[model samples]
Target: MPGWALALPIALLTLIPVAAVIGAALSPQPEVWDHLIRHVLPRVTANTALLMLLVGLGVLCVGVPLAWLTALCVFPGQRFFAWALMLPLAFPAYVLAFVQMGLFEFAGPVQSRLRDWFGSSAWFPEIRGSLWGTVLVLTMAFYPYVYLLTRNAFVTQGRRALEAARMLGESAPRAFWRVSVPMARPWIVGGLALAWMETLADFGAVAVFNYDTFTTALYKAWFDLHNLGAAAQLAALLVLLVLVMAAAEQRSQRGRSYQVASSHCQPIVLRGWHRWVAFGACALVFAASFAIPIVQLVLWSLSTWREELEPRYWDFARNTVLLAVGTAFIATTLSLVLAGVRRRHADRITAWVVRLAVIGYAVPGVVLAVGVFIPIAWLDNLLIAWLRPLGFEGFQILKGSVATMLLALSARFLAVAYHASDSAMQRITRSQEETARTLGLGSWGLLRRLYLPLLRGGLLTAFLMVMVDVMKEMPITLMTRSFGWDTLAVRVFQLTTESMWENAAVPALAIVAVGLLPVVLIFQRAERIQGA
Candidate 1:
């Protein structure tokens, strides 16, 4: 089939859910909107805005200083900190939330120990399930997004700018603030935009904390209220917020360029106590973000081994692996085809279609779940009606099936696979394709003998990236999974909701272990960026 022919189906599949979302938004019930606006909308909007503000401040406070230290200064354990700081990326915010609650709740170890030392009436800070706690956990998990981008910016570009300021008699700190930071603002803002988008899309973490945000509000509207139209309207509002953020980010970046004249500039190196200070700060952030939570999880897992490591746990793991592997394979294959087609036949329509398909990544998982479910429910009804005349009464195919789950997962993660494959394809010169065509090789032959060989690394990278993301995905799986379709993520959510943090630890650890793959990849990529 021609490249465009293959892309057309993928584009249509991608757009169906989006169309459903729009349809739902347009057709909301009058009563639901009236109630939502009077009571729910204002509160949800305030909480979401406040959460975003706090998270943004928290990420900057932690991520920016660490990025500056790692990029510009020599320190004790600098090499280790460079990668270790990113290990928190392996943790989902919800997992950390449960772990922190386990360690700090009223009956948990910290408070118990405090009561042991002092009186039961003694004062201790309340840390679990609060807005501050949620902000802390989310910042720990997502600061890497800012750190990675900002560190790369500082290392590759800020050094020259900083030097120019120093030559004009500015002090070191003054030069950093006046020159290096301004030059790196674009990248820093871009990183913050990514962090905020992830924050807005998050459901599991906020849900666990019992903090009402837009994601949780959307979930409640759909599942709790059973108001699909209200859910869709909420989702539309969330999408509009995301679009505004994207536009603001673009506008902030307008008329400014951060690229340096060269990528080979030497970074600054600290000495003596300055180095130790940098080292201690990075170490503290790493310990709080990654090491501490993981250790707590391990301790909890060991205590609950008999219960958590049973056959049921294995089943959840198996289901998770199956879904993740299946989604990765299918998504990567489709990405390869779409990217290859675009490469071979570059045109405006194909480019626009590809862009439209990849936009699914920006949609929140809960919104995507609702969008996907609406169509699948409709299609299942149509199928059952057709099948009833053939004597297959009460037959249902799409709803509550792994097929629907895969469809949702593919729509959610296809952008990851596509970008990875597209990057790989761009590196393969067109002359190679010309050379293959001269040998009378057709498209399939070209793919088999040439493209596959060249794309092997990229395909695997895309697969692993998608697999890791799928393993940690929460809202989509939680909303869509059938009976007996529990994955590790869903198991974590179930246990956490029940306040069974010890039992949740096993699956949460499994998710973190799987998530480590992409974190390692990210670390390696950051190292390469700096080393360049």
Candidate 2:
């Protein structure tokens, strides 16, 4: 069989879930739509739009300036903040949401201390379950997506265009506004769209904050309402939103390449007050977003460790690790296969198939849970029908099983694994393959002898990346997990749902620890990109 054929199954797997969702949406669900359009749609659409607008502006305001300061100016701790700013990415947005609420809520320590000091009448702003709180939590958590891309664009392209604008007698501010910002528009806009997509797809953070969005609506449709049709319809709508956002992002990247790497242009040097201003700005963002929350989580964890570190906590940890490890291995192997097929064939069929297979990453996990569960449930029912004649009266398979969860998760994270594997695979020269062919080695032998060593780092990266993601994933597992399969992410969700943020801290901390590996790898890659 041709190598391209290998990806057909993988591609089909991705399509089935989306197809199932859309198909269910098309089917008449009068009762469901009556409930949704009346009670759900109006509120969800408004909240989603408002959330996007707020988050869009918030991320840009917080992220772009930080990127500019860290990239173009010589400021105190510029090097450290360059990477440290991304640390918030290590904590899932939901984790950050609860942590912030834990600290800032009316009954929490900060407010408690304030009420004690300044009397109960002291006007303190309420953050929990409010727009300000939701936007702030999401902005802090997601700004790294914007900062990473824009900072790289600045670091590589540097002040070359800025120099030209300066030569044209443009004011420094005007020069930056005209040259630098426009030049990095694609990255900035692309990053913004990406953040918006994440914001739109988010379930846990919004759920924690009691903010209504499509994701939360979808979750309610399936679990709360027990209406599969409604869930599928909601997922279908979300899929459309994702598609639109993707189109906008694609359009942003299509123009002439603005990415120009030149080392000659140096960073602008700041004088006394200006230097301190830059330092303070970076420090404040870093502290608020990452360091402070992390410290609070650790303290909370330490305080509650004796009780929260019980056997069930270990069970959650074990489940989290198993899910992460299982999904990572499956995703990595399949990704490596898809990557190999694309590399060896270089045909459109394979290329398109690979694209389809990897696109599951963009689809929200809750959508995947619904889409995946429906088809598998149908198959399980079919098996029961077939086995009934042989006295297998109640035999059920693939529904609410670990295999089902793994499949859904693998679909969701396959892209992460594929990108890592494909990148490493690209580093192998064609000449090496030709030489291996000349030596009469078959495909297996070539992969075993030549590609294995070269791919080790990439596969490990893929594994770790997928592992961390699975550890942090909430909606999918929450929706589809088998009985007693609760994970750390789920534990966090449970506690946050009950407003028990302190107890949720230990598990959140563990997940954050695992998540930090990828952030470190990301920073290392950014350094490499800058150097290159």
Candidate of highest lDDT: 2
Which residue pairs collide, candidate 2? none
Against the true structure, what is each candidate's TM-score? 0.96, 0.97
What is the Cα-based lDDT of residue 196 in candidate 1? 95
Model 1 C-alpha lDDT per residue in residues 1-532, reported as the tens digit of each score: 5656668788766688878887877888899899889978999999999999999998888888888777777778888887888888889888988888888789888889888888782576676558988898889988998898888777777456676787889986787688777777877887798789899999999988888999999999888889878888888788778778888888877887556656544556788788888888998899888898999999988998787888888888898889999999989998998898798677787788888778778888988888898999899999889899898778768888888899999989999999999989998898998999999999789989999999998999999999999999989998888777899999999999899999888889888988899888887787776656
lDDT of 1 at 231: 86
Model 2, clash count? 0
The superposed Cα distance between candidate 1 and the true structure at residue 377, in angstroms, equals: 1.0
Residue 51 C-alpha lDDT in model 2 = 93
Q: Which stretches of candidate 1 lie over 4 Å from their true place?
A: 1-6, 390-395
